[model samples]
Target: MPGSEHADRTEDGLSIPRHRVLVTGATGLLGRAVYKEFHNNKDWHALGTGHRRARPRFLRCDLLDEDAVKAVIRDFRPDVIVHCAAERRPHVVERNAEAAVDLNVKATATLAKEAAASKPGAFLIYISTDYVFDGRDPPYGEDDTPEPLNLYGKSKLDGEREALRHCPAVAILRVPVLYGEVEHVEESAVTALWDQVQEGAAGSCMLDHCQQRFPTEVRDVAVVCRALAERQRQDPSSVRGIFHYSAKEQMTKYEMAVAIAQAFHLPASHLMPLTEQPAGAGARRPLNAQLACCRLRQLGLDVQPRPFRTAITDCLWPFLPDKRWRQTVFF
Candidate 1:
């Protein structure tokens, strides 16, 4: 019934059928990229849903509120729903377990249910994390058993289960550390390394060298999401189940810091790599949860990642105190 409405016209005033894409947590790092990707695509119309930071283009909706979520789905009737809203912070999830479950698990279930009940039954893409796998044995495949190290990972795993349970056609995408355009450097784990690099420049600073992370770019993940959405749109049963999408490049926090220092031409003599994990932490982190991109590659999707050195430098350029240095290094 939703598709019976008059089709929108393209630039040439030719009628073009468009897929309605709804992205949750549009204000967040990955959500922003996903929203932008769909918004820019000529084949689809994107509507981003956010809470605190909701803007003119984004719809303001608190995911925790079941009524609000149902209303959003019922009204929009999106053909594809990219669910990115969740309590992703490990320490924060540890601090507030109830809130994490409510947002991560309950909200996901509600969204999946609402999407499934929609007129055309929207294809859902649930954004998960590599933390679902305990860093014991990796790279983890699609069917690999998930053993979460912390509550954050467990919550995400639970969210994935909820999404799959309600919507069988859901695509669960698990990614590692993400970096991209950010309102602030502290927003992303990889970009936050610049702060550590700055700290190291002044005095002795230690970063985790033990844990290996495949830092994937948000824009790349957005592309993957778009591809998956297109695949699902073409054939509903084609894209389903768990999918791992991550960068091939591997680097520890210490290594990332070193790279940041080198890019900014800062002194790295004071930087030290901690070989062992710190004691008495709020939540335990995986040593290395390298996600295998076998499923994505097999699907003929572009799993290749941008070069870390060049990408990271470009991402951090705006934050550089001196703009003159960018003309020489970046330009």
Candidate 2:
């Protein structure tokens, strides 16, 4: 309830009364942000779950295990369940299809069904990805038909379908690359680059790939999720379907690298450019995965209008002091 007063004054406002909420994937980057956003609300009781380590109120739970998930649903009886857990590495999913299915698709389906049965009016928000599209087009809207190119996208699409089928009140939020600071492993793109520069490597830069994308910051997504959760509590019949949430501007990976270098006063010359090519023998990536957020804005969500450079700089502020870097190179 720390930011409740401000959170309550949003467009949809706090429509639902006080109730307990459950946040899965509480230890992940975006999940941690969401947990922080809702943790202090006096009106709503916030309980979270992590796969291994215990967060403040988090209970140990592996979402892939249906019995464990069902037990959480029965015990917590949350009014709102925000599902942010998933196996996101594309090649990893490609290599281990069954684990991906078990965790991303099966676990999500289990949670959705249990939430629907346990709490009739509960709202279930599934965090999905913009990679669900084939990326033939540059900017994709909410209603645009998805043509997923890989196993990761296929599995998430499957989860989305399952959520819609079982949960009457569900919000499938498709977001793009989530960047933020949590642990060393959870550092943002900007942070990763800054670490490289601090390590005395010629500052790093991405190749001039034509690929464009709408990157969603971890904090911003958390804010929207909390807002939507409140709205669902207020009006169960409001609306239900896919919602795109991301920064308004589209930025190429190279442009993003330049911005990160500038944030720390590094010379652009220090950054190297690499062409688009397969890393090792993995899946080919989409050249353009930008998302359109008009529907979310129409619904009164605050979409940041600045360019991605500004957003990247903001996300990099906290991690500059760490001064660490990864030697693994990618284009």
Summing lDDT over every window of 10 consecutive residues in candidate 2, give the lowest-scoring window: 322-331
Please give, for residues 1-331, the per-residue lDDT of candidate 1 as tens digits: 2252357766898765478889999999999999999988867778899999997768999998899999888887888999998889899999999999999999999999998898868899999999998999988998999999899999999999999999977999999999998889999999998887877547899889999998888999999999999988777776999899998888999998898888878778788999988798679888889988887787798657888887888789999877897776767
- Backbone clashes (count) for model 1: 0
Predicted candidate 2 versus true structure: per-residue lDDT over 1-331, tens digit per residue: 3232223443666443267778998888888888888886656767789987664557889887889888888877788899988888888899999999888888988888898898455689999998899899868888898888889998999999999998888999998877775476234443455554444364443554465756667878988888888777666666488898877656665566666666556556655555655455475556777788776777787555446556666566555553342111111
For every candidate, C-alpha RMSD to the true structure in Å: 2.0, 6.4
Score each candidate by Cα lDDT.
0.88, 0.74
Model 1 segments more than 4 A misplaced: 1-17
Clash number for each model: 0, 5
Candidate 2 Cα lDDT to native? 0.74
Which 10 residues in a row give candidate 1 its minimum summed lDDT?
1-10
